[model samples]
Target chain A: MKRVEFFVAVLILAVCAGALWLSRPVAAAEPPNTPRAASDSNDGALFTAFVPVLRHPRCMNCHSKGDYPRQGDDSHRHTMDIRRGPAGFGVTAAKCSTCHQDHNLGNVHLPPGAPAWHLPSPSMPMIWEGLTDAQLCQSLKDPKQNQGRNLDQLVEHLTEDKLVAWGWNPGPGRTPVPIPHDEFSAKVKVWQAAGAPCPSR
Target chain B: MIGFSVNGKRVDLDVDPSTPLLWVIREQLSLTGTKYGCGMAQCGACTVHINGEAVRSCVAPVSRAEGKSITTIEGLSPDLSHPLQRAWLEEDVPQCGYCQSGQLMSAAVLLREKPAPTDEDIDEAMTGNICRCGTYPRIRRAIHRAAEMVAKGGAR
Candidate 1:
């Protein structure tokens, strides 16, 4: 009887040990700390550097939701009944090229111009009006939302697009972006290099 | 010399190109119909048609209008018979009548584009032009009336 009791105790001990072994691996496979640590520290820092520049009026004015791109720092509705026609330029009689010249008017208060003097074509407005930092970061990373741009392509656009460069050289009576263009480009590079993380909130 | 066409007449002005078109229209040529409410482009009171499209003449430099065709409120019709003007009268669209010219100039553009514009379209096009007396309801009704006149093919 004593020997039988001893065997039963050993069997119970073996079952308990097996349960412990199976549960241990599951926690190891998805350690909760890993993502929290990565998002809170590394990616969060990268997103911190990106949100302000994207939110600046220079970017927000054109990246808005409506059919018409805003004008001026106040983001006032563009006068002249200008709508972001199919191609983001004005409609037939009111095309952007009607007045916006190839270069900034040296004279103050004239409509500032660029080679392709139009808003981001209505097709891909890339609205960033009121998004939280996290949402905007996520949207930027998504190819579907970022105009099919990968990180490298986005970097090229931010650094080389002439219209975007106009933010730095916005003509007279307007303030340029606060961060130097080069510095702004550099921040983008760092964020992209670090895998473009979105912030917690 | 800044040369341009106004109301089908070609004219050249020796004024500085930096001069606002409002000055050239109101002071130089004396087309006083294009009222100047704000020196800035905020008020659409100085609205005019540059190549048949509404533009705020107050902030638009004379140089930009140098070669363009400009149409002022006074040019819409010799005797105020343009469909929009006729509708304005029928609907009693003016209160103080200060902003009527600019409102008509903008409404004309809308009629040309969408002769049968819905209420939303009118709201979209006319929001920039402000009427101090708040004659928006009358203006909106007038726009609808104008659209009907044009669609009836008797607008002229």
Candidate 2:
């Protein structure tokens, strides 16, 4: 009975040793601290960089849910009987191109223009008017709400779309988006690379 | 070069496309009846007909007039014989006469669309055109008179 017990103990010791050896390579292959830990620190700051640009009147003017797009930094209702036609362009005779051209007019107080100048279509107004930073972040990341764009496409649109770029060069007398386009683009990429994490607040 | 007809006259010019149709009509074509009250299109003093649609020419780029027929206030009548024009004179619609051309042009479209326009239709159509002289009441009366003439088949 003593000899049988010794054999059993030896077998158990061998099994334990085999399990440790098998796990050794996996432990070495993994990073010292997961990339998630390092990126968690930066994701919030990276996304925060986008807040000011998104909240600026230039961006918010057409992003609201109102049937008519707002104008000026004051965010007043657009005059001229403009209504968001089935599409974002104004209704009937008050179409956006009726005043706004492909480029800004030479003088101040005139309609600032861009290609496809319009508000978000009524079906998906993509309203950011009253959203908190956290809500904005979540809505932006949600494909269902963001015009069916994934993270990379969202980055491309916010960074490269001509209409979006108009926020930076919003004609004469208008204050532009807070961050420079290049820096904003970089921050967006960083946020994307970090898995597009949402902030708590 | 952009090509379009202004008041039944074919015009093909090499002006910058971004030039406002108001400038093209007033300066280039030498039709000055359409006054420029507000360049921002807020006030409809520069109203004109683009293919029979009343569009504010001050904010409408000439490119928008490309391939379209443009009718300025000058084209409304040869000798001020249009129904709206006669009605304007009959009702003394012009106080300052600055916004009259735009008012007449806008009224013409409204009359065409609604031969017998109520006060509400006139108000809805002519609201964009502003007359600083406070001649709205007179303008409304003139539109009703013009509508009556059209309904009677008295004027083309």
lDDT of 1 by residue, A85-191 (tens): 77777663355654565567665776787678787676677788888888887788778887899878887888788988888888898877778887777666656
lDDT by residue for model 2 over A1-201, one digit each (tens)?
999999999999999999887776422333323334434744467578778999999999888767778988998987655677677775433456656777787778888988989887787778998887778998998887888899778988998999999999998999999988977876677677666777777
Query: Per-residue lDDT of B82-143 in model 2, one digit per residue for the tens?
Result: 99999999998898799999888888877876788888667756767788899999999998
Per-residue error for A171 in candidate 2, Å, reads 1.7
Candidate 1 TM-score versus the reference: 0.68
Clashes of each: 0, 0
Docking class of 2: incorrect
lDDT of 2 at B106: 84
- In CAPRI terms, model 1 is classed as incorrect
- The lDDT per prediction is 0.79, 0.82
Q: Which residues of candidate 1, in runs, are more than 4 Å off?
A: A1-51, A64-122, A129-156, A160-162, A169-175, A186-201
Error of 2 at A99 (Å): 2.3
Compared with the true structure, the alpha-carbon lDDT of candidate 2 equals 0.82
